[model samples]
Target chain A: MLNIIACFKWVVDEADVKIDAKSRALLMERVGYKISDYDRNAIEEAVRLQEQHGGNVVAATVGPSTAKQCLKDALSRGPERADFINDPSFVDLEPEQTAAILATAIKAKEEYDLIICGEGSSDLYAQQVGPALAERLGIPCATCVNKLTLAESKKEIIAERKLDDGMEVVSMPLPALVTVLPDINTPRIPTLKQVLGAAKKPVDNITLNDLGQTYKPCLQTTGILAATMERRRLKFGADEKNILVIIGALLKEGVIA
Target chain B: MNFNLTEEQELVRAGVREFCQKYVEPLAEKVDEEAYFPMETVKKLTEQEWTGIPYPAEYGGAGADYLTYIIVVEELSRACATTGFTLECHTSLASYPLYKFGTEEQKQKYLVPLCKGEMLGSFALTEPGAGTDAGAASTTAVLDGDEYVLNGSKMFISNSPVAGVFIIIAMTDKSKGTKGLSAFIVPGGTPGLKVGEHLNKMGIRGSVTAEVVMKDCRIPKENLLGNEGQGFKIAMMTLDGGRIGIAAQALGIAQAALDESIQYSKERVQFGKPISSFQAIQWMIANMATDVQAARFLTYHAAWCYDQGLPYSKEAAMAKLFASETAARQTNRAIQIHGGIGFIKGHKVERLYRDAKITEIYEGTSEVMRMVISGNLLR
Candidate 1:
């Protein structure tokens, strides 16, 4: 019986984020947050493994108190319980800081056979948290895992890692950490019943004070600028000659290739 | 008063909106083009337990409030009015009455599975001869010992062909007029109960509609819903709730039209400038925006009144009437903004245009709505 924990982040929905052209800044006033896309796969895999084997799946996240909304969103995806580390300081934690907090929460929360995380968050794509978390917990960890299955004896997990060269298979004993790729599984949307059931699921809140980690930033100095797209503002009359010119330009540009 | 949605309500909207965008929106065009019932989406919704929102937890419901129900309807209708129509029929028309008026045994046998989405529920009230005059139902229900034998035919029965359970209105004593009307819980495919072919419609085609013919359709005495003479009151009360559903559907349709129009105005260029810059287009867009907002206020207010246990029949009627008319007008302008493309087939604006018209016709007609409002005020 495996007790699994899926670590996720509530990140701004990029679709709703607007870029300020003049200031080169990202405007987040109208943006809403969602469970990071890759984290969805991690959650699905945890739930899937639990369904296949008899166990419990707990979803854990680090974010502000407003992120309590994520509790229902994640639990609806089939997790039995949730551990939320909600603190104002959690808003902009570096990868290592995030890893330390998650490790502390996991250690304090439950005894787990496996832990899962996305390769990286949608916002940063730093890809550092999963390995750093494993190091913090002193567990063997695998990254870029696209496919995973438990051995028949349920002693260890066999994971298929997706690398640039090709697929690599790795096996490790219990109490391991695996960072999942998006292709690992297509996450299922919570049905009406699942959404309703989420309301009944138990959620525990862990504070920054509970983690007992002194907040210090090892990574310094960051700057962000919005990338702007330049498009030609060419216009032509809707005549046969203009139509031919448009087709010729398209052909020359190999757009019609 | 606190007008902002609660945190939970906001979350429900965000979750349902995401679901609709990912799953419901893509298939909406195909459902309209093929006039398909969207069984897959329906199955998914049922499996997810969305079919039972606003019901109690003990009876297989989500235990969500009525406001959540409105949000679900609004979001679904924004994607496809047919889906909204189908869910409304199930929630308000079919299952709601059973939940409100059914005996404990009836609730156990029917309401539980209905909330669990085991089978689609349908309501049959409109007859060939009776549309607005629900009290004038000619369908007869005769008490024959252990069973009540029904002989009647209903027209424009939504979900008739696909329904697993039905709430049928029949008259036990014609002399008493509307007071004589009674409701029955008739299981679908019962002996002598025939569901006719799917009726082709101009809008909301994705929801199946058909005629229901009952020829000596016999149900046990226990199947009779509410008291013998309370059918008219029950049907009216059911419709009072249903008007909110229809109004929410109309709000969704209008909101979609307004959204499409705004996007189109920004993208569509003419005379070396986007059409949105023109004051003529701006005026139309402005009207549409205001109308959509006003309708939302009316619809949400009615839903709130219902939830608060306030007398909301007049408010619901006004909301339905205004929202449906606004939807018709907004869709018309949405097409104008899209120019020739909006009129052409395969356009979302075109589909919404067709879908918008039915909201005014069904549940309670715009004319009936006015009568309800005026009657309430005059009294």
Candidate 2:
């Protein structure tokens, strides 16, 4: 493989994401962003491939200035380097738009043999970005790939893609797009040593203007909407009141035994 | 008497079993063959916060009880006895005393690091002369001004050679007899304290077990654990918990051996049929299965009682007694069933047979367990 560019995302921390009480929007204030869980899967897969086939695994993300942390985490994982398209407007881009921005940035200075992205983001779970990005770049795309075995001689791969029923095994040419499932490979934790190394690794910070791509929204929200909180129905224990109420309900329904 | 695990308990078992099956099983042989402590494996465990499992979460532990701790130990032991032995030393011996008796400041200083897997801890209650009778310990931490000058050596101590901290017991008030003893928190690299060469062991060979030599080692007076005359009681109380862990360890090795024997029985052909089809083979497997189940029941019941805060000292010793001895029989039977294959160096049953012998020896001997349990009842 020549180069593998993995698509990453910086979102509100999955653990801390909350909803705004009034607006019903995901409360993002002070909820520091991180790379989407699946995106880490992509980065690990790319790194694994790089280790096997000898190439560079570059991490690319389109997010706000704070999104740089996602690239930092990705580099900490196993990527050769990272590129970030930092713009306030990049925060709300849909799969296609995010892919478009990343594609432009990836194509600007370097040519890649393969483009790898996660099957989907945990927050949105859209399952669209990889194919759409590949279409935009005009390369063959494979999604939900569970296994990747390279044929170094042929410069191709035998991939097993996860399907609804089971798994579909296929082979693809070198210059392709692959969206990986989380099971493709377990992501390695950054050792304290690796974390320190990541702090020093150079990450390229590129603007939307630098990639010759402007803000373009593929999907837009009407307004900031909070999550509709669902209340759990409570069940009473074997207290006297609960027993009496159960007996009353049983008599009403004519099924007391 | 409850046979079913609660939901949280079930989750604990499943999570631990899954982690061990996926991560530990593949590299277990290499770990044993190489005598490696496996930094990568410990790093993975640190991610799950498995190092300090039985203590409260405030102390950097997983906040689980004895049952949950055994679940982790049993699963890890199933694949790799080395890791299980290491965890047992940390949780059941070194750090547990601090959790039960140490002051808040002491816990913060010693317990947190060990429980978080940030630092490995060791227990030094055993001396060459004091193998079974902790009261016979010759190591003395004589009070001198603001410090206690510790002199004497500890032998067959687990995790000592590589440990960051050691919880040691020594005579503080010699005239008071056993009551004269006290425990101390000896930080590694304290001047005059030396970790001797690692002891070569027959089983659980991957985990480091060595001698600790203390030559006029001085520790602050604050290092005393509990009261000045409580060392013997503390060491014995800690062993009550430690016995449960040894039971879990024995069960793990026996289960692995049984599983291996079953597979071999099905695959190995004898007298024109799979050995599994033979009545003698069937009988041996039957005995192993029943014994292993019996051991598990005893171990889990002991753990359950401990979790419920009941008087589990009798139950724990019973569990340790039955499980360790039963594992020895089960592993021996497994090896016999495999015949020549089981005697080979690389065979799983061979390793199990070797591993099974140690469980009966460590954490107090099987004979020692009977004495303790009987002594408790007589009291």
Candidate 3:
């Protein structure tokens, strides 16, 4: 049976993030954290695979110590156990730093036949950690995977990558990495028994000291401001001439394309 | 002294909320409209061991406390009151009696499956002639050597159509009045046990209720729930626990009404601003929230008392009285907040309004609750 690891991130629930009108900074008071959206798809895919093919699914995540909450949530979604990398310093880690830390932590824990990740974190959508971690671990990686299947011999992973123009079919050898899109599958809401089972599942919480890894951010964000859209309150009568003018303006602005 | 939920309790809420939103809420309207019992969802609930929330793990239950049962009932009712009604009845009314009074063999035969979700249970204590006066049951059970022949009719029995196990109360001795009554374990398909057509209900339409007619229905002497003369006491004891479940159900309905009102107030625009900005709407919302919280505390406290093995009849009565009335009032105000739109059929508020009234009437009526509370205090 395949031994797979599903990676996840805990992100602020964006719905609760309010914008300070004057400072344009996010108001994070009373905010809650949830497993990153697409990361749930990654976990769900892992669970589905385990259900179809007898295997062990372990959920792994790297975040602040508070991110321990993600372990129960992931395990509830059908994983057998969880491996949590908790470090306060990882809160603002750049994608490369996150990948390095996760690779180190995962390697220290156990060998896995496959590693699944969301295409990117919901907050940053960096699309870097999966491929970067794969590179560090020297395993082939696939991104934007919409459909995936394991070979009968379990030596290869066949993935359908969703691209801008068309879908690309690619196969990576066993012990590979694949970052999935949200469309990979709709994550199931864990049933009551599954949730209770999660409480009993083992969670291995690893710290930076446990991993014995050191990472430094290579990219820095100076600031972030909320984007505001201003709608033009244009009033036009039911006339052909006005409509045509509106269409022309839309065409010039590339809004119609 | 701790008001905060334990991590396990919180997990129960989170897990149930997610499940109800996906499985129960979507079917609420369709069930109400078509008057269809949701067997699939019920099966799913059984699979999750929710049917046995407050029972023991050895009996194939979740081994959860009464408070956990309250939480499960509250959350389930919040999404669909009918489902809440059915679940609470099955847990508190049908299964409780067997669990509390049945012998080890009886527990093994009935309570185990009831808690395991393998079989659904119903309490057939209510009769046309005996609504609040449960001791007035005309149903007679004659001792016939090895079997007791049951003959009577019961009205307004919840889960009668779907339940495989029934906790039936019948008179074993007429001179004993309430004391002569006895409860029995009658499994479905027992000859002479007939389930009548489903009665159309104002609310909780999805939970099947019907008349159960027993014409010479015979069961082995071993099927007796408790001693022959202990039926009224058993019924009263069962209703004491049953009231808390109904209270939780009412609290859930009231909470849903308040929640809908809050959401509606924000989205509904009036006089160039949201209705929520109006002081009048704000006042309604505030009052509704207070009532819901009060009902919740009452329900939870009663459930807690039961969990601690304390005398909780008065508390349960108080909780049911307050919570059921709160539901009725809150649903009315919820409808008022929605105005004409709320009165329209198929509207969530309208359904809630209709559903709220039954809480005041069933299990124990508000008047019965008052009597129970006052009588206990006077005693």
Candidate 4:
């Protein structure tokens, strides 16, 4: 049986975030957390693989104390259990530090055949954690994987990576990592029974001290500003001349070539 | 006095909210427009094991508390009130009585399948002659040897068209009045049980409502719920719990109306600025928001009381009264905020306005809710 680890991130629900009218600063006071968008795909894929291959799927995440709220949700999606490595200091963790923590936690597990991650977190689309964790673990890593098939007896995984130009097919040995795209699969909405069942699933809460680590951030996040676009308010009559002028304005604004 | 929902409760709400957005919200318009039951969505709900969220797992339920079940109903109603009412009627009106008063044999035979969603359940209490005055019901059940033969016609029965089992109340002793009422578990397809055609309704149209006629319908004596004279008490207690569900449903309808109004106000521009900038529109929205929040607290508190095993008959009545009125008022304001568009067909607010009215009418009327509340207080 193949054992899989799905790594997810608890990010702020962007829908709930409000932008300041004058300063364009993000208002996060009332914001709630959700599993990062693509991370849901990663978890679903892991669970699907486990269901098909007859194995166990454990979900893992690195975040602050509030991130504990995401564990039940993650578990409800189909994980057998979860590993939450939480620290208040993890609030501002960069990609590398996050990857390091994940790698350390995975090493503590008895055995795992595959590790899956989203292409990137929803808040910051820095696609580095999955590959970095794989590098730290010294395993082959695939990025932008939209499809995956496990050949359990052969100890290999066949994956389809979605690239800008075309799809790339690759076969990698077991114990490898793949960061999946959102389109990999439509995540199943956890059923009421599943939500209730999640309460019985085991969760291992490992503090920073439990991992025997001292961490320093090499990268820091500055203030986040909302992206605002000012309307031009250019009025044009419904005529060929005005349409031509609109096209010229669009070209001048670099909106169209 | 913890106002916050428990962790599992919050998770249930979020999960149900997500489920509603994906499955229920998409078909809401079609369900209303065609006045058709969305059986596909019902099957999905059964698949999700949400038909019986509050019951014990031994009976094939999710084993969550009443608050979590309320949350599920609220979220489903927020998307489609019809679907929400369908579940509420099945669980609260039908399955609840059996769970509360049925014999062990009756539970295993009936409640299990209802909880598992293997068979839909319905309650038949209202009749042509009985509305608020349930003691005036003319239906009769005469015990003959090993069976009780039933003869009656129930009116405005929700889920009768699709239900596999029915909790039917009939007069076993006319001299005893309300005490004479008796409840029985009659499986669908029982001899002489006939479900009439679907009734045309202005609100919650997608929920199947029909006439259930029992012409010499016979069920085993073992199917009697509780004692022979306990039907009225069982029904009243069941409705006491069912009021919480209806209150939650009202809260959902109001919340949906508020959401639609807020979104529309921000988008619809007048005087070169969004109408939300105007004090008149802002006042309406503020009132709607306040009312919706208050209704939610009342509804949730009632559900919490039930979960705590506290006496919540009065609380449920109060919540049903306040929340249903709030729903009616907020939906009206929502339509006012939407202006002409809200009156047009296919608009969510229009459908919500139609759906909100029934919350004040069914389960218990607002006037009845007041009577219940005062009756408790004066006692």
Candidate 5:
């Protein structure tokens, strides 16, 4: 049976973030967290694969302790179990750091035939974790995959990659990793029974200490400011003369050139 | 007094909200305008296992708590009150009595299908002359051989026209007054059982309501629910739980109205700025926000009581009374906030205003709710 692992992230719901008018700072005091948008597709794809081919799907994540809520959410989406690698200092880690931590955690876990991840996290679109983690584990990796088909032997997979110009098809053997685009699948909303059942699913809480790793930051983020746009609150009368004047102004401003 | 929903309950709420946004909200206007039953959406709900959320897994239910069921109703009603009421009637009024009082055989035969959403269920108690005075029901069920023959006519029975099974209340011995009442399970398509044409209503139009007529309709003797004299008690307890669902429905309607008003006031400019800047509109919004929150607490608290296995008759009555009245009052304010636009056809607030009125009158009227609350205290 194929044992699959789906990697996910917990990010602040961007819809709930508020912008301060003067400081251009994001207000996150009351903002809630959700499973990163594309990661939902990753988890869903893993579950779908398991349903089609008899196997176990385990969801894995590395984040701060606050991200514990996401374990239940991932499990409710049909995963058989969850692996949470939590450390308060893991918040806002660089993509390379995240990949490093994930590699360590996966090495400590059981064997896996395949691994799936989102093309990019909702918070950071770096698109580096999947390839970096694959390099760490010395596994073949494909990025931007929108479709996947398992070989008859269940030891190989054919993937369709979405590119800017066209789609590319590639085949990889078992024990490979793929970063999936959102178009891969529409995630199913969990029924109430599934939500309740998530409570009974086993979750492994692994701390950095358990991995026997000392954290060192290779990169640091200084600040993030909201982009502000200025609107020209121009109004003109509906009369013919004013309309002509407005047209002249628009022409002078090069808006109608 | 931990005032937080469990993690599972929260997840259920989120899932239901997402479902309603995609499936329920898109069809709401058409449902209201055409007075068409949303059989498609109902089927989707059944597929989600929402038809029997609070029942046990062995019985084909979701095995969730009553509070989780209440959350589902609230979120569904937020998108479409008619759809919400349809589910509430099926789960709270029809399926609940069976789960609470049915024999093991009865549950296996009827409750299992109801929980699985294989068949829709209905409860019939009110007659033309009965209204709140349920003891005045003149329907009779006389034993004959291996069956009981039911003769009666029920009015304003929700889900009657489309129901697959029904819980009928009738007198087994009229000389005993309310004590003579008995409840029976009558499957659809039974001989001599007839359902009248659907009734057109002001609000919640998509939910079908009709009259049920029985002329010597005979059900198996095993179809009797509970004991013969226990029908009144069964109905009263069932309604006590059903009121929590209705209250949740009312809270959903009120929340929808407030949501519309808040969004409309912010975008609708008048004079020099948005009407929300005016003190009058702001005050209305403030009152609406407060009232909706209050109703939510009452409704959720009642559901919590039920889940805790506590006596919540008074709590349920209070919730139904307050939430229903709050919905009616807030929807009116919501219309006023929208000016003439709210009165126009196709506007959400207009439909919500109409939908809010029924919450005050159904299950139990505001008068009956007050009587129930006061009676609990006086006794």
Candidate 6:
């Protein structure tokens, strides 16, 4: 049976995101989390391929200790098992650093014929990580893939990658990486039975130290500018005479220009 | 309990807001003015499988909880009330009947597509003289052996012109009063089933409300919804969530107007200072903000109740009554703030002012909502 390993993230569930109005920061207090929507897409693709060609699919995510829900959600959706890199230190990893840590986890396994990942996480949506992790792993990777095929005779997979300008189909040997589009297939929801069963299923918990890096940090950012651009406002007066002044002001500001 | 939204809801807000602003708002006014239905938008949403929110995925719908559906509807309406209304009534008024009562085969054939948004759907309940009192429907469906011959007219029904199929309520046993009413799925262009001219409306014009005339509309007995005598109850139950949609619709219109007004206040100068600096304008904006937020919480709370499978009729009615009226007040203030400019035909606030009032009238009027709320309290 083919073995597929899907890389995923425990992100603030887009469905439950709460933005702090005051600081313009993402809220995290009892703020619910879930497997990133894109990563779920990637994992679902792996599950589909496994069902198609007889394989075992293991889903994995790197997030804080509270990210068990991400692994649980993934496991409930047909992955044989899951990996959650748990630690508070992981609370603020940049995209590149995250890719490195995930690559280390994948390398530690030293197994699996294929690796799949979401095109992007819903939280950041930077469209990084997947390809970056592939680079770190020294494996061939394709992003925005719509089709995945396993050629039994050739012992390889042929995949179709959609690009902004055009499309390309590439053949990757075993131990390859593929990032899938959101439209690839609707991610199946975990039922109550699956939710209960996830507790029994194994979710291998790893930490940042498990990656064997003594010192920490890479690609540090200066800081985030909250509300990068303030929206321009133009109001009209309460009375009819002021309406002309407002219109004239709007016209002068080139708002109506 | 903190009634504020959690993290996932925020993400939903951002994404849905982006979608609505980019897709819906730009075309909203034209849709309302021209009565042009968005077949493309419907097709796009169905393809993305967004048509069915809160319905179980097993039935080919999103299976999101009711709260999630409300959030989406509110966001969609914030961008374009018409788009939200289409999905709201389509699912709540038309498809809910099937999900509540249809057999397995019926669900597979009709419920599946309706939830999938693969086809436009509607509830044919309100006739010319029989809107709030749907039991007064003059439309008659007589049992004609294998097929039921339906001959009645439903007026002011949204999505009629473009609806692929309709969930029609007809009097099968008129002598039995409301108990004798039966519902059916009448496919569009079924020889005698036709959509009448679109009604020109004050706002949310993108949603086409027209008369659905059944001139000997024929359908197999298999298409009968629920038991032979349960249409009115089904109709009432269907509007439970449908009312919430209108409330959210009110919230959306109010939210848009308030957003515009606040932004405008910050920029427009008065007494050699930004109008936002004035206490009076700030007070108006503050009240508008609080009212919109309160209405949102009420609507969302009712939606959450539905998700928990609890009784939410009273909460739903309360939300509808408060939100719609609040929205009208806010929109009226929005126009007042903008003065003569807001009174223009094209300004967002003017459109909002017009749009806000409909929420009070449709699904259930404020008085009707009060009755529903007060009536539920008695029960």
Task: List the candidates' TM-scores in order.
Answer: 0.92, 0.64, 0.94, 0.97, 0.95, 0.72
lDDT of 4 by residue, B35-123 (tens): 99999988988988888888999887888899998998999999999999999999999989988998788889899999999989999
Assess candidate 1 and give its lDDT: 0.90
* lDDT on C-alpha atoms for all candidate structures: 0.90, 0.82, 0.90, 0.92, 0.93, 0.80
Error of 1 at A158 (Å): 1.2
RMSD versus native structure for model 5: 2.7
Candidate 4: lDDT over CA atoms? 0.92
lDDT of 5 by residue, B247-355 (tens): 9999999999999999999999999799999999999999999999999999999998898899899999999999999999999999999999999999999999999
- lDDT digits (tens) for residues B82-167 of candidate 2: 88888898889998899999999999999999888998889998889988877888899988999999999999989888789999
Q: Compared with the true structure, what per-residue lDDT tens digits does model 1 show for residues A1-257?
A: 89999999999889898888599998989998889999999999999999999899999998888778888889989999999888976777788888988888888867999999999999998999999999999999999999999998798999999999999999999999999999999888776557667888999889988887766779875877888876666677898899988888788878896
lDDT tens digits, residue span A50-102, model 6: 88888788887777786554655677678888877768777767778788888
Looking at model 2, residue B276 earns an lDDT score of 96
- Winner on DockQ (1 vs 3): 3
| Residues B13-103, model 1: lDDT tens digits | 7767877888799999988998889888888778656787888888888888887888889889999999888888899999899989999
Any runs in candidate 2 off by more than 4 Å, and if so which?
Answer: A1-183, A187-257
Model 6 chain A poorest 10 in a row by lDDT: A188-197
Residue pairs with colliding backbones in model 1 are A191-B48, A192-B48, A192-B50, A193-B48, A193-B49
For this target, which candidate reaches the highest lDDT against the unseen true structure? 5
Candidate that would win on DockQ: 4
Q: Residue pairs in steric clash, candidate 2?
A: A24-A225, A24-A226, A25-A225, A25-A226
lDDT (10s digit) by residue, model 5, range A47-117: 99999998999999989988888988999999999999999998888889889999998987769999999
Docking class of 4: high
Per-model DockQ: 0.44, 0.02, 0.45, 0.82, 0.76, 0.07
- For model 2 the local lDDT of residue A133 reads 85
